[model samples]
Target: MSEANAPRVRVLVADDHPVYREGVSRAIKARPEFELIAEAEDGRRALELVQELNPDVAVLDVQMPGLQGNDVLHAIKRDGLPTRVVLLSAHLDSETVYRAVASGAGAYLSKESSRERICDAIAAVARGEVVLSAEVQAGLASEIQIRERDQRPALTPREHEILVLTANGHSAPDIGKQLHLSQSTVKTHLKSLYEKLAVNDRAAAVAEAMRRGLLE
Candidate 1:
C-alpha cells in the first residue's frame, strides 16, 4: 500500500493532561495509517480545532474544566463535521458510561487501557463502530437486567459506593481504590448505574441522584 493512500486517519487529541494529550498525539503520529492533525487542551479549543481541521476522528477526554468531551461530541454532530468522536477518558461509572454513549459519542475508551486501546478504538470508530471497554459493555448489560427486575435500579453493592463517589466528583481511579476494585471495574459499575438511572452524563447523574436523595 502506498503511504499517502493509507486511510490517513487524521485525529484531534483533546485533553488537559499534557502527558496524555502528547502521548496520544505521538502514538497516532508514529503509526503509518494515522495522523495527528491537531490538539486541544479544553473543550472550547477542541471545538475550534474541529472546525478548522475537520479531522477524521477526535480522541477526547471526558472531563475538561470547561466544554467537556460530551459537548464536543454534540458540536461535532451539530455542525455536521465529517469527524467522529472517541472519548478517551478515565473510567466513569456505568451511569456516566451509558450517558457518554447516549450522548452520541462514536466510541468510549478508557484512559487506563488507552495505550494500545485508543488506537484500536479510533480505528473502529473511523469505520463507524461504537466501542468501549469490554467491561463497560458487560456492565451495561447487567445494569439493564437489574433495572428490568425492579422497574428501577437495584444497584449492586459496588455501584452503591460508586454512586456516592461519582456524586462527589471523584475520579474512577479514586473510587476504585476506595472500593478495592480496579479502575476499569469502577467505570463499568458507573456505566451500568448511568443506564439504570436513565441519565446521559455525569452532571445529570449527580443532579438526578441529588434530587432522589441518594447521596449526601
Candidate 2:
C-alpha cells in the first residue's frame, strides 16, 4: 500500500517533563505510521485527552503530576476505553511492573530507551501486543526471586485456609461459620497470618499470599 494509504496509528504523549515529551513528540512526528494526536503535561490532562480523542495508543510517563500513569491506566480500564497504553518510567521497579501487568497496560519501557525502541513499542501496543523491555524482565525476575525467598512457611494449615477464603471474598464471620470456628478465632488467625505475611489487613494478606504463591 502507498504511504498515504497506510493506516496511521493515533498516539497521545503524556509526561510532566517538557524535554522528554518533546523528544517523544519529535520521534512520533518523524514516523509516518504514527500520528501524534495530542500531548499532555499532567495525568489529568492526559486522561481528558484520552477520553476526548480516543487515540489508538497512549504513551504515558509513570510519574506524572496530578495522577500517575498507573492511575490513568486504571481509569481507562474502569471506563472501558479502547485506547491501549504504554508506560514509560525511569526505573523498572517490581511494583510498577506488577501494576502495569495487573492493570492491562500494553507495554512498559524505560525513558532511556532509544527512539527506535519507543516507536516500536508504540506500534507493538497499537497492534495489541504486550511489550516489555529487558530491564522490566530483569526486575520481574528479581521480584519473583524475592517473593520466593520470602515465602512464609510459618503459616499453619488453618491460616492458609483462612487466607484462601478471604481471597475468595468471604467475610470473617462467613469464614468462621464455614470453618466451624468462632468469629474471634477467625480474626485471631487472620491477625497471625497478617503478622507472618508482614501485612496489616486481610486484603493485604490475601494479595501478599497470592503474590508469594501461598494461595493459588
Candidate 3:
C-alpha cells in the first residue's frame, strides 16, 4: 500500500496520570500514520477499551490502579486478542521486567522514555516486534543472572507434592495422611525438600520454593 493510503495504526493510550496520558494522546494524534482511538485512566478501563475497541496497539502504564499493565497484557494473550501491548513504567526492577516479558507484553519501556521513543515502540509492537528500553533490557539481564545464580534443583514428583502441601500449611503428618504415606516417609521427603531448597526450616523452604516458582 502507498504510504498515504496505508491504514493508520489504531492506538489506545492508558495511564493513571492525566497529564501523561494527554501528552501521549496528543503525540499519537500528531503522528500522520497513527490514530488515537481511546484513552483510559486505569488498567481495568484500558483492558475494557482494548476488548471493546480492538485497537491495533495499546500503550499502558505498568503500575495502574485495579489491574496492572502485565495483568492487561496477560488478559489480551489469554483472549487471543490481536492488540499489542506496550508497557510503560517508572520502576525498572528486574522482577518487573521478568513479569512483563513473561506475560507477553510486546514492548516494555521506561516512563522516562521520550514521546517519540514510546510512539516508535507502539509502531514496532503493532508490527509484532518486541521492543524494550535500554533500562528494561538491563533489568531483564539482571533477572536472568539472578535466576541462574539461584537456580533450584529439579524437584521430584513426590517432593513437589510435599512442597505444595507444605505451602498450604499442611503439617508433616497431615501431608503424609493426605498422600497415604507414612510419617517417616513424609519426614524423609521434607528433609530432601529442605536440602534441595537450601533452607533449614519449613518457612524458609516455602519462601525459597515460591521465589523459584517451584510452588507455582
**Candidate with maximal TM-score:** 3
> Can you write out model 2's per-residue Cα lDDT over 1-216, one digit (the tens) per residue?
886898999999999999999999999999999999999999999999999999999999999999999999999999999999999999788867976887999999989999889999999999889999988998877776776666656688899899889999999999999999999999999989888888898888888888777876
- In order of listing, the candidates' clash counts read 10, 0, 0
Clashing pairs in 2: none
RMSD in order of candidates: 16.6, 8.0, 9.6
**Roughly what TM-score does model 2 have, to 2 decimal places?**
0.69
Off by over 4 Å in 1: 1-4, 146-216
Error of 2 at 205 (Å): 18
**Each prediction's TM-score against the native?**
0.64, 0.69, 0.70
The weakest ten consecutive residues by lDDT in model 2 span: 144-153
Error of 1 at 184 (Å): 55
Q: At residue 187, give the lDDT of candidate 3.
A: 97
Q: Give me the runs in candidate 2 sitting further than 4 Å from their true place.
A: 1-4, 144-216
